[model samples]
Target: MDNVQKSMNLMGLAQRSGNLISGEAIVLNAVRSRQAKIVILASDASENTKKQFLNKCEHYSIPVRVDFDRNEISNAIGKIRTVAAITDGGFARSLQKLQ
Candidate 1:
């Protein structure tokens, strides 16, 4: 599969298993709690949201990706307004290939 497809697939798996954090508050919580293995921010995410997530990720030494737009990210993660933080390692690895 292509990078986008791969990301979507991994995201689907995450969603099915209840491993997803789809909202801003939950994402921020995950980041602050340091439970995130990797942080994926939508390219079109607002500057403030992006900055917050990136800053947290950097503070925690977590890796980050901005490869896809909001639609692509939301589609992949199976949400409409997802804007920040954290995913399972497999998804993280798949996204890493795109980077």
Candidate 2:
């Protein structure tokens, strides 16, 4: 399978394992708590939203990925989310490897 498919499957696994958090408020909270190992923002997200997340992630010293668009991310985790966070180190490492 392609890298994109692999990444999406991994996201599903993460969600099933309850290690992925999505949505703005939840993800921000996770970042603040240092529970989020990686933050992913949809590449097609609005400029303002993108800026806000980028700044917040930067301030928290959290890693961020903006490789996928809204649809791709939403479909991957079976949620309509423009932002998501991987809380587990193993999942985060696996996802990063797909980049």
Candidate 3:
């Protein structure tokens, strides 16, 4: 599989391993509390959502990735979500490397 596919698969693993947090409210809380090692924002997210997350991530000095669209991300996690946070540093770095 290509790197993108691998990344999506890895996201599934992360979720199953309880290392990923999804949904806007939960992710926002995770980012605010510095519990998130990295944040992934769906590329097709609304402009306001993109701006809010990008700015919040920038403020917190947390890494952010804008790669997969909402469908791809939701498919990987088995939920209809546009945002998610990786709490494990190792998984965060792995996702970053895949990009």
The prediction achieving the highest TM-score against the true structure is 3
Least lDDT summed over 10 consecutive residues: which range in candidate 3? 67-76
- lDDT by residue for model 1 (1-99), tens: 676777667766776777667677887788788766677778888899889888988898888877778888777766786464546766566656766
lDDT of each: 0.73, 0.93, 0.97
* Tens-digit lDDT string for candidate 3 (23-99): 99999999999999999999999999999999999999999999899999999999999999999999999999999
**What would you estimate as the lDDT of candidate 2?**
0.93
Residue 22 of model 3 has an lDDT of 99
Per-candidate TM vs. native?
A: 0.83, 0.95, 0.98
By TM-score, the better pick of 1 and 2 is 2
Tens-digit per-residue lDDT, 2-63, candidate 2: 98889889988999899999999999899899999999899999999899989988999999
Total backbone collisions for each predicted model: 0, 0, 0
Could you tell me the lDDT of residue 51 within candidate 3? 99
Candidate 3: misplaced stretches above 4 Å?
none
Worst 10 residues of 2 by lDDT: 3-12
Kindly give the stretch of ten consecutive residues in candidate 1 with the minimal lDDT sum: 82-91
Candidates 1 and 2, the one with greater lDDT: 2
C-alpha RMSD for every candidate:
1.9, 0.9, 0.5
